[model samples]
Target chain A: MRAAIRSEWTKLWTTRTVWWALLGAFVLMAAAAGQNAIYVENGDVTTASVAVMSVTIAQLAFVALAMLVMTGEYSAGTIRATLSWIPSRGRLLSAKIAVVSAVTLVTGVAVGLLGGVIASAIVDDSGSIAGDAFKIGIYLVLLGALATGLGAALRGPVVTLVVLLMTIVVIPPLLQLPDIAVLNGIADAFPGVAGGHFLYGDADPYPPLVGLLILAGWAALAVAAGWQVLTRRDA
Target chain B: MSITLEKLTKRYGPTLAVDGLDLAVRPGRVTGFLGPNGAGKSTTMRMVLGLDRPTSGRALVGGRAYDSYKWPLREMGALLEAKAVHPGRTGRNHLLAMARSNAVPDRRVDEVLAVVGLTDVARRRSGTHSLGMGQRLGIAGALLADPPVLMLDEPVNGLDPDGVRWIRGLLRDLAAEGRTVFVSSHLLSEMQMTADHLVVIGHGKLLADAPMTEIMGGHATLEDAYYELTGSAA
Candidate 1:
C-alpha cells in the first residue's frame, strides 16, 4: 500500500498539470480575498464571512486538480498501464484517493491561511481567522476527494468538470430561489451548501457534525460508485 | 510457467470480442497470435493481462489467476499498446512508477532502458519520441521485471527494417532463455520469421494452433498457409 501511494505521488509530481492547478488555485484565492476585502470595507460583510468565502472560492482549484488526477490516466490511456501493474482495482483506487486527499489537505490549509491574511491586511481589520480557515480547509479536503471519485466514474474531462461545476457553481444558486421554502431548506443538504455551515458556525440550519457527515457522505458515495465502475468494467 | 486461457469469452454488448477461445502458451518457445483486423487478438491479450474482464471463463498465468500473483509484473510482462502511457512523463519516470509498484529495483529500470537502446533519451518525455522510439520504450518497460511470460501486440508495427530484425532476434533470445513469448501480429510474413509455433484465429474463434512447420506443410511459405487458414491472402 505504501508503494502504491508512492507510485501515485510520483505520478502527480512528474506531470505538470497538478502544479499548474495549485498555482492557479493560489492566484485565484489571493484575488478573491483581495476583492472580498474591498467589499467588507464598504460594510458589505463581516471579516470572518469574507475570509471564509475567499477560501471557498479557492477550493475550486483543488477540486479541479483532484479531478485531473484520475482523468489524466484515462485521457493519456495510462490507466490500463496502471491497472496492468496493480491488478487489484480497489487498491489502485484507494491509493489515488489517499494521495489526492493528502495533497489537497495541505494545500487547502495553506491557501486558507494566506487568503485570510490578505483579507485582513486589505481591510485594516485585526480579526483572527484560524477557526473559519480551518473549516474551509476541511471542506476542501472532502471536495477534492469527491472530485477524484467523480473523475474516475466519468473519465472525460469535459463531462467531469461540467458535472462538478454544475453541482458547485450552478445548483446551489438555483436552490436559493426565494419562493420555495422547502427547496431552500434542502439546499443545506448539498455538499456545497452543507459544508458552508461549518465555516459560518450557527448561520446554517444543520449543526457542524451533521454538515460534516453530509459532505463526507457525498465523497464516500462518489468513491463507492467509482469503485464499482473500475472493478466491474474493463479499463 | 505458462499462460492458459480456458474457454475464455469476452462480449462487448452484442459484439463477441473473444468467443470461448482456448490455448496454452508455454515457456521455452515463441508462440505467435495471428489474426485479421478485428480478429480478437488484442482482446485476448487484454484478458490474459487482466486489463479486460472476460464475460465468462478466465486466464491463468503460471497456473494461477493474475491477481493471485504477489508481483504480477514479476510473473507476466505486457506490451499491449506502445502509446498506453502518460505522454507528459519522461521514459525514466514512466518505468520508475511501475518499478515502484512491484518493488522492482531502479537498477533494473536502467538495465532495461539500456537493453532497449533507449538510455540516451531516457530523460526525454515519451510524447516527444517517434513511434518506433516509443515502441522501444514500451518494450523497455515490459522487460523491467524480466518476467517469465512476455506478451506483445504488434511488436514491430512502426519499426524500421533494422529495428524489425533486432526485435525478431530479441524475441528468439528471450524464448531461448526459456520465457514464454506470446506476440500478436496480423502480418503473416513477420510471424513466420519470429514464431516457432502459431495460434491463428478469425472472427473471435481459433482456426489453428500447431507448430509452424506442421501448419506450413506443402506450402511455399507460412504466408501461403496463413492465406489458406485465414483466407486473407489471394
Candidate 2:
C-alpha cells in the first residue's frame, strides 16, 4: 500500500496537469475573492462568506485535477502498465484517493486562507480565516474524492466533467428553484447543497456535521461504484 | 519463470478471441507467438498479464496468476503495446513511476534507459518521440524491473533496421540469461531468425506449437511453412 501510494504520488506530479490545475484554482479563487470583496464593502457579505464563495468556483479546477488522475491513465493506455505493476485494483484506487485528497486538502487550505486574507484586507472586515480555510480544505478534499471516483467509473475526462458539472453546478440550483417541499429536500441532500451548507454553517435543515456526513456519504458511494467497476471490468 | 496456459479461453460477446489454448513457454529460449491479425495473440498475452480476465481456464506465470504476485512487474515484465504512456510525461518519469510501484530501485530507471539507448531523450515527453523512440521507451519500461519472464506484443512494429537488429540481439542475450521471452509478431521471417520455438495460431485456435526446426521440416523457408499451416487452418 505504501509503495502504491508513492507510485501514485510520483505519477500525479510527474505530469504537468497537477501544477497547471493548482495554478488555475488559485487564479480563479483570487478573482472570485476580489469580486466578493465588493459585496463585503457594501455590507452584503462577510469576509468568511467571500472565502467560501471563492472556493466554490476554484474547486472545479481541483475536480478536474482529481478526475484527470484516473482518466489520463485510460486515455493514454497506461492503465495496462499500471495494472501489471500493482495488480490489485483496490490498492490502486486507494492509493489514488489518498494522494489526490492529500494534495487537494493542503493546497485548498492555502488557496482559501490566501484568498480570505486578500479579501479581508480589501474590505477591512474581520473574519475567522483559519475556520474558513479549514472548511474550504475539507470541502475540496471530499469533492476531489467524488471526482476521482466519477473519473474511474466514467473513464473519460469529458464525460466525467460533464456529469460532475451538471450534478454539482447545474442541476442543484435548478432543483432548488421550485417551491415544492420534496424538490427542496432533494436539493438539500445533493452533494453540492450539502457542501454549501457545511461550508456556510447553515443549520436549519441540518447541522454542519450532518452536512459534512452527507457529502462524505456521496464521496464514499462514488468511490464504491468506481471500485466495483474497476474490479469487475477488464482493463 | 515459465508461463503456463491451461485451456485458456476468452470470448468477447459473440466473438471468441482465444479458444482453449494450452501451452507452456519455458525459460532459456525466445518463444515466438505468431498469428495473423485477429488471431488472438494480443488477447492471450493480455490474459497472462491480467489485463483481460480469461473466460475459462487459466493463464499463469510460474505457478500462480500474474496478479497473485505482489510485484508482478518484478515477476514478469511486458511491453504489450508501444507508447502506452501519458503524452505529457517524460519517459524517465514514466519508468520511475513503474519502478516505484513494485519497489524497484530508482537507479534501475536510468539503467534501463541506458540499456535501450534512450538516455538522451529520457527527459523528453514521450508523445514527441518518434515511433522507434516510443518502442524503445516501452522496451525500457519492460526491462525496468529485470524480471525473469518477458512478454512483448508486436515489439518490432515501428523500429528501423538498426532498432530491429538491436532488439534481436537484446532478446537473444536476455534469453541466453535463462529468461522466458515470449514475443508476438505476424512476421514469420523475423521470428525465424530470433525464436528457437514457435507457437502459431489462426482464428483463435492453435495451428502449430513446436520447436523451430521441427515446424520448419521440409519447407523452403519459415514463411512458406507459416503460410501452409495458417492457410490450412484458415
Candidate 3:
C-alpha cells in the first residue's frame, strides 16, 4: 500500500499537467469570484453561494486532472509497468483512492478556502457562512474521489469527462422536468444534486445527511466499476 | 526466476491474437520471442505479465502467476514497450518512481542509467528524448530492480547500431549472471546474434521453441528456420 501511494505521488508530482490543472483551478476560481463580487452589487446571490459558484467551474478542472491521472497511463501504455510493480489489483486501487482523495481534499479545501477568502474581501455582506462549513470541506473531497474513480473505470479522458459532466451538469438540469418530477426526484437524489446542498443552503431540496449518502453512493458505484474494469481488462 | 507459458490463448472478439501457444524460458539463457506484425507476440507477453487475461491456460513465473508474487519486481523486469516512462518526467525521475515501488535503492537509478549508457542524458525530460534514448531509458528502468527474469519487447526497435550492440552485450552479460532474459523482436537477423534460444510464433500460435543451434541445424540460419517454422516461404 505504501509503495502504491509512493508510485502515484511520484507520478503526480513529476507530471506538468497536475501543476497546470491545479493552477487553472485556482486562477479560474479566483477570477470568477473576483468578477462576481465586482459586478453584481445588488444581486440575489448570497456571499457564500457566490464564492461556492466559482467552485462549480473549477470543479471541471479538478475532474479533468483526476481523469488524466489514470488516462495518461493508458495513453502512454504505462499501465503494464504500474500493474507489474503492484500486482495485487485491489491494493493498487485502494492506495490510489486514498492518495488521490487526500491530495484532492487538500487542493479542494485550499481552493474553496481561498475563494471564500478572496470573495469575502470583495463583496460587502453582513451574512456569515453557514455553521456546517466542515461538511462543505468533506463534500469537496468526495467530489474529487468520485471523479477519480469514474476516470479510472472509463480509462479515457473524453469518456470520463463526458460522464462526469452529465452527472454534474446535464442530469441536474434534466431532473427539473415537470413531467418526470417523481423520477427527477430520484435522479435529484444523485450525488450532483445532493452535493449541491453543501453550497446552496436552505434552497437545497433534501437534507444534508441524505445528500451526502447520495454522493457517497455515486462514489461507491464508480469505485466498484473501476475495480471491475481494472481486474478484467488488458492493461 | 524461470518464465513459462503453457497453452496460452487470447481471443479478441472473433480475432485470435494468441492461439494456444506454449514456451519455456530457462535461467542463464537469452530467449527471443519472434513473430510477424500482428502475430500475437505482444499479446502473449502481456498475458505472461498478467497485463492481459488469457482466454485459456496460464503464463507463470517461478511456478506461480505474476499477481500471486508478493514482490514481482524482484522476480521479473520487463520493458514491454519503449516510452513506458511518462513523457512529462525526466529520465532519472522516471526510474526513481519505479524504483520506489519495488523498494529498490535510489542509487540503482544512477547505476542502471550508467549501465544503459544514458547517464549523460539522465536529467533530460523523457518527452524530449530520442526514440533510441527512450528505449535505453526503458532498458534502464527494467534493470533498476536487477530481477532474476527480464522480459523486453522490441528492445532494439528504434536503436542505432551502437545502441543495439550495447543492449545485445548487456543481455548476454545479464544472462551470464544466471538470469532469464526474454526478449521479443520481429527481426530474426537481430535475434540471430543476441538470442540463445528462439520461440517463433505466427498468426497467434507457437511454431518453434528450440536452441539456436538446433533450429539452425534444420535450415541455413535462424532466419531460414524462422521462415520454415512460421510456414512462410519468403
Candidate 4:
C-alpha cells in the first residue's frame, strides 16, 4: 500500500493536470472571495455566506482534479499498465483515494480559510473563519472523491462532468421549484445541497454533522460503485 | 518464472474469446505466442497480467496467480500495447511512476530509457512522439522492472527496420540471459528468428505448441507452417 501511494503521488504530480487544476481552484476561490467581499460591503450577505460562495465555485477545480485522476488513466490506457504492475485492484484504488483526498483536503482547507479571511476583513465576522472555512474545505475534498468515483465508473471525463454537473448544479436547484416542490426533500440530500448546508452550519434541514455525513455518504456510494466496475471490467 | 494457464477461458458476453485454452511458457527462451487477429492473444496476455479477469480457470506466473503478488512487476514485466501512455507526461516520468508502484528504483527508469535508445527524448511528452517512438517508450517501461518474465504484444508493430533489428537482437539477448520472453507478433519470419519455441492459437484455442524448428521441419517455412496450422493460407 505504501508503494501504491507513492506511485499514485508520483503520477499525480508528474502529470500537469493536477497543477493546472490546483491553480484553477485557487483562482476561482480568490475571484469568488473578492466578489463576496463586495456583497459584505453592501450588507447583502453575511461573512459565512461568502465562504460558502467561494467554496461552491472553487470546489469545481477539485472535482475536475478528481475526474482526471482516473479518467486520464483510462484515456491514456495507463490503467492497464498500472493494474498490471500493482495487480491488487483494491489496494491500488485505496491509494488513489487516499492521495487524492489528502492533497485536495489540505489545499481546499487553505483556500477555504483564505476566503473566510477575505470575507471577515470586509464585515464583522466572529471566529467563524476556522470552523466554517475548515468545514467547507472538507466538503470540497469529499466532493472531489465523489467526482473521482464518477469518473472511474463513467470512464470518460466529458460524460462524468455532464452527469455530475447536471445532478449537482442543475437538478437540485430545479427540484427546489415550487411546481416540483414534492422532491425538495430528495434534493436536500444531493451533494450540492447537503454540502451547502454543511458549510452554512445553521441550515435547518439537517444538523451540521448529519449534513457532512450525507455528503460523505454520496462520495462513498460513488466510489463503491466505481470500485465494483473497475474490478469487474477489463481495463 | 514459467507461466501456466489451466483451462483459461474468457467470454465477452456471447463470444467465447478464449475457450478453455491451456499452455505453458518456459523460461530461457523466446516463446512466440502467435494467432490470427481476434484470436485472444492480447486477451490472454491481459489475463496473465491480471488486467483482465478469466471467466473460468486461471493464469499463473510461477506458482501463484498474477494478482497474487504484492509487487507483480518485480516478478514479471509486460508490454501489451504501445498506446498505453499519457500524452502529457514525459517518457521518463511515465516509467518512474511504474517503477514506484513496483518498488523499483528511480535510476532504473533512466537505465531502461537508455536501453531502448530513448535517452535523448526522455523529457519529451509522449503525445508528441511518432508511433515508433511510442513503441520504444513502451519497451522501456517493460524493461524498467528487469523481471524474470517478459511478455510483449506486437511490439514491432510501428518500428523501423533498424528498430526491428534492435528488438530482434534484444529478445534473443534477453532469452540468452535465461529470462522467459513471451513475444507476440504478426511477422512470422521475425518470430522464427527470435523464438526457440512456438505457442500458436486460432480462435483462442491452442493449435500448436512445439519447438519452432520441429514445426518447420515438416513444412516449407515457418510462415507456411503457421498458415497450415492456423488455416489462413490453406
Candidate No. with top TM-score: 2
Error of 2 at A222 (Å): 0.6
Superposed model 4: Cα runs more than 4 Å off: A47-49, A124-127, A179-181
Model 4 DockQ (Cα-based): 0.83
Alpha-carbon RMSD to native, per candidate: 1.3, 1.3, 2.2, 1.7
Position B7, candidate 4: lDDT: 98
Give TM per candidate.
0.97, 0.98, 0.94, 0.96
lDDT of 4 by residue, A105-212 (tens): 899888888887777776665346777667777888789889988888898888998988887888987889864655888898898888887787845777877888
Model 3 lDDT vs. the true structure?
A: 0.81
Order candidates by TM-score, high to low.
Answer: 2, 1, 4, 3
lDDT of 1 by residue, B176-197 (tens): 9999999998677888989999
Candidate 2 chain A lowest-lDDT run of ten = A41-50
Q: Which stretches of candidate 3 lie over 4 Å from their true place?
A: A38-41, A47-49, A126-133, A177-187, A201-204
**Candidate 2 off by > 4 Å:** A46-48, B232-234
TM-score on 0 to 1 scale for chain A of candidate 1:
0.95
DockQ of each: 0.82, 0.87, 0.73, 0.83
Tell me how many clashing residue pairs each candidate has: 0, 0, 0, 0
CA lDDT of every candidate: 0.87, 0.91, 0.81, 0.87
Candidate 1 local Cα displacement, residue B206, angstroms: 1.1
Ranking by DockQ: 2, 4, 1, 3
What residue runs in model 1 are displaced by over 4 Å at the alpha carbon?
A47-49
lDDT of 1: 0.87
Model 3 lDDT, residue B22, Cα: 74
